[model samples]
Target chain A: MLGHLPYALAAWLILWGLYGIVTSRNLIHLVICLAVLQTSTYLILLAIGYKAGAVAPIYADMPAGTVAVDPVVQALMLTDIVVEATVVALLLAIAVQAHERGGSLDPARLCALKG
Target chain B: MLAPWPVALPLVAAAFLAGLGDKLPRRLADAIAIGAAAITALCCALLLAGPPVVYWFGGIQPRSGTAIGIDFAIDANGAGLAVLSSLLILAALFFSLKYFDKPAHMFQVLLLVFLAGLCGFSLTGDLFDLFVFFEVMSAAAFGLCAYKSREVGPLQGAINFAVTNTAGAFITLSGIALLYSRTGALNLSHMHRMIAGHDDSLVLAAAALVCTGFLVKAAIVPFQFWLADAHAAAPTPACIVFSGAMVEAGLYAVARLQGALFGLPQLRTPLLAAGVATCLVGAVMCFAQRHLKRLLAFSTIAHAGVILCGIAVLEPGGLSGAGLYVVGHGLVKAALFLCAGMLLHRLQSIDELALHGRGREVPWVGVLFALGGLLLAGAPPTAMFFGDGAIHHALEAHPIARFAVTVASIATGAAVLRACGRIFLGLGPREPDAPGGGEQDEEPETEAAPIPWSMWVPAAFLLALAIGSAWLPREHAGSAAARMLDAHSWATQVLDRAQPAMPSPPPEEPLAKGLAHAALTVGLAIALALLTLFRKRLPEILRGPVRAVWNPLAGSLRALHTGAVGDQVAWLTLGVAALGASLVFS
Candidate 1:
């Protein structure tokens, strides 16, 4: 049960973010919630790459018999990190623009185009 | 290998353009973008002429006979998509010269990067690589959507799009992570092989999440609120990219991944149901929209639903029809948007009522708009007619699906035709629609702006491509379909290369039925247009029931899209969960 903690934690983080988004009023908070959700994915990736008793995945020629964690997930996590940074930056920029132009970042008032 | 050139060249060019932002002349920047797009299109054409090419990254081979390393795999369908995207990119750039007033070096760079991302996403065989390319494409799209950052509408649209799509992407990444944990392979084919016999809940959940992400981008129902706002607020050239290829790329990801990786038939029922719902909602909303770009965006959603129906058939004929439909739809939609752009540029308004009889002076413009409407109606001798006919053939056995497709095709066609009649043929009231309804000021006035040859040329070129394919020998389409449907051949070629067998093209309807279907579709569109033109004159009894049914449905649909970012995000989350539950239980 304890070993499954990462899965539960990742899921909780995702759900927490969803809840935050559903209730959030402003663009900045919504973006922050999205970042929180993205962090869950990173956690999941790290969990997938984790090994119970493994050394860092490098060829130092020091541990011939030692096990190594999967490097692929780490690499994927790195990519995800870069993507998250970009998305957050872009989202923040849009939020700032929204605040400046629309006079508010409240999701309720950002009704520029609707049905 | 040449397989990577389609992706590499555009990246290099985009970097150069972005780096040289103000230093480079605007014309030079535009020329470089056009040249890169043309070369990419040529590369895609050359690739389609040959067999599938799979280029493994970093010289990594299969480890002890297990597939590893990322591969740039370009099959005929992938090549076709790449070609379509690059061609549309080229057209969009060509049109941008006159469409944008000043130097837009950053815009050109974002467009090229978006082009590279699209080509890469279509051709990549690795799930993670697909994710990266999706991010690249989407990031550029966010910037492009809010290119005019001073405007509240565009900024709001971009913000809503960015937040929602980012959430969706994170969900997709989570799905990828789940799949990786379940099966330690990122290569699509290898993962497919690994998960062949597994019927685990985890796998189903992951598939659902991945599909949900693409579905959001594809603007499927419940996940589609961002699309109209984004498209309507975006610049015309950017709208071309959004509607023409970007949305289709999302659907392509869903099709390529599901058809190639999971190979599950359980998806058909859910896909069919969601597709039908999407079709109805798109057509109904399209009918209600007064904004020209919003109307086009809704129709894009509707066509995406139609394509989904074709894909849901889970057969060779369906896949082939889907491929052809995407190509046809992209070309026609881009042309239609370009024409709309011209109207907006000239009159400073895209409101149908305001543009009434306005196009009468430009006979060629009217003809082009009418032709585009006919093409949208699936008129024969256009690729859309053949593609729609193929989808009908695929769904012949499923009566409900067949009926849905018929209604959707006719209704969507009717909506576009109605626009053409009102705006071009002056079929309706000459009075402005809902005076001061906040439609006129959507775009700034550009009076007496001469429609340049550059603007109309790309529209004409895309229109010809959409229609000219219909005049081609049926065998070309047939062969392309056959190639797209033969997943076994694709898998073997990329994996083992032992079997070189190719499947023959599926049988299609005789020319007479296709002609009849085309006629019926056109007739429905005309009838709908006439009805709309004389709606106020209709008998009270006849209009009462129609209004009763339509008012409630439209009201509910509109209420769901409250234009709030939080509301949209909640809906997206619900959609993801709903999709996962349906896939798991079904």
Candidate 2:
């Protein structure tokens, strides 16, 4: 079964990240928790495309028909990373403004929209 | 053939507008956004006019049988959605010309990017592209929700929206990774081919994760906590698009993926259950609201649930019914939000209690608001009426579903009607202690002035479409629904370069049944609304009994929607786990 270790690692990261997000008091920490959660996807994508005993996908220096890790998933992972960066940046910016306006970053204290 | 333009055009325009921010005149920026949306809509309409197309980017043909590059597998349904989104964007931009003040071209830029994302999400043949575009839409939406960030309310709303959705997106990406690892395919058609008759745990889990991600976007129950906050705080123009098209995109992706990759009957139960739960829950919470935007937001959730029900039936009649319902419901929801915006602009308040009888000042908006409620209640010959007929015919095999749909429709409609009575007619007793009701002071987006025709005209235009686009005729709707679900033919066309043949649509939904259901819906909506409006006039004995029974149920139902990000995320995770359990075991 292609070594379930990576899957376990990804699952653990996901759980840990969710736990952080659920328990975090501050908005910055929540955003970071979200980033941590996003990191699990990166790991999963890389693990899926990983090829033990295979070379990198840089075919420029490799012999023809050599086994290499999947370039497609790597490409997807790259795009996903870019997207995560944008998301984290945007969330962080909002957190900053929210802190500025409310003088606090604790979501519990940000009681404007809650029940 | 025209697939890419619908997406690419808006993106390029957005980027251009972003670059020219504040340097260009405001009027020019508005023109650019409006022009771009119009052209993109035209392009989508053109795509709809043709046979299904598979336009590969950079001309990377998969003639050798492996999908090497991204492609757009455009069908009538996808093109129809893209056209709808583009048109809504056009309407929003038109309405916003006089709404915002002291803004750079930022709002226009965000809107155009949002349009691009919506188009891309609608037409893309690849799952990864769907995620990318979904992110594009979400990112732009977060920006729009936070554009001014002048108020604490908007900031709180934006933060919750960003975190929860980004989390959902990551889950979806992981799902994509799981599926890709199993099938070695990214293109949906190719994935379908690779997954031939496979219903393994991996597939189930991936399906659960992916659908969970989309349900978040669709703002289904549990994942729906962020929507009311976002919609309530977002600008009126942005709210129109969010409620009208963006949230619905989530449901579309779920259906599209189901048709393409996993059309197993096992998954149907979970989908239907989720749809019904959202429908009932949204209705209950909608009826218990005091904030007009939040009320409309919850109503959006309720109708989205109804649309999901149609898709869950897994038939052409139901699919097409949902399609027409989406057009009818989404447009009416947008019009209603516009009415709310009008109230916000003219009276500078949206609190149900605070704005009591204030709507008389803006009689047109009040009339439009009440009319939107009537359409929502399934007014005869309206688009929703046809949609309801189709759905009822489809769900005829499931009688309990019919009752559920009926109850949900009545509750949501009556909620709107009751609000109309209170805000416009001053008929209801003002109660202030309801949960999350009438909580925020809306910052006026424009100067103190008469409400402009620019705003009301667009709402009226959208309402006209909502009321009458049923003229689209049942046969054509049936055909479009058939094509939308014809996975085999769609795969053959997209991957093998085969000319697609149209399939026959199901028979028309029985009009007699639709009329009966429609009358019941409207009559109950009116009666319930009037009851709530004049409930105090009821004898003390009846009133006491009603409150004793109703207050606790409504309060408990409303309490579950705590509007906290942590609780929402927790519920999302639990929902995903539950969805996976049902898909895996059932």
Q: What is the C-alpha lDDT profile of model 1 across A1-113, one tens digit per residue?
A: 89789988999999999889889888788888888998999899999889988888886886576789999999998888888888888888888887887788787776743
Q: TM-scores across all candidates?
A: 0.96, 0.97
Q: Model 1: clashing residue pairs?
A: none
Q: Please identify model 2 stretches exceeding 4 Å from their true place.
A: A112-115, B429-438
The true-versus-predicted C-alpha distance at residue A3 of model 2, in Å, is 1.0
Per-residue lDDT of B1-586 in model 2, one digit per residue for the tens? 5777888898899899898867888778878888999999899989977777889999998866778889998877788788789878888888887787675478888999999999999999988989999998999999999976878888888887887888888888889999999889889988888886887888988989988889999988768888988888899889989998988899989889888777766777888887888888888888888888888888888888888889999888999898888878878888998888888888888888788887888888888999999889887767788988888788888776777677778988999999999889888777664445435667878766788888899999998887667787667777878877777877888889998768888988667878887998999999999998888789998899878977898788767766678888898889888988998876
Q: What is the CAPRI rating of model 1's predicted complex? A: medium
The fnat of each candidate, in order, is 0.79, 0.71
Those runs of model 1 whose alpha carbons end farther than 4 Å from true positions after fitting are A112-115, B435-441, B445-448, B471-489
Tens digits of per-residue lDDT for model 2, A1-115: 6489889899999988988888889988898888889889989988888989999989898788999999998888789889878888998999899888888888878864333
Top of the candidates by TM-score: 2
**Sliding window of 10 residues with minimal summed lDDT for model 2 chain B:** B432-441
Q: Total clashing residue pairs per candidate?
A: 0, 0
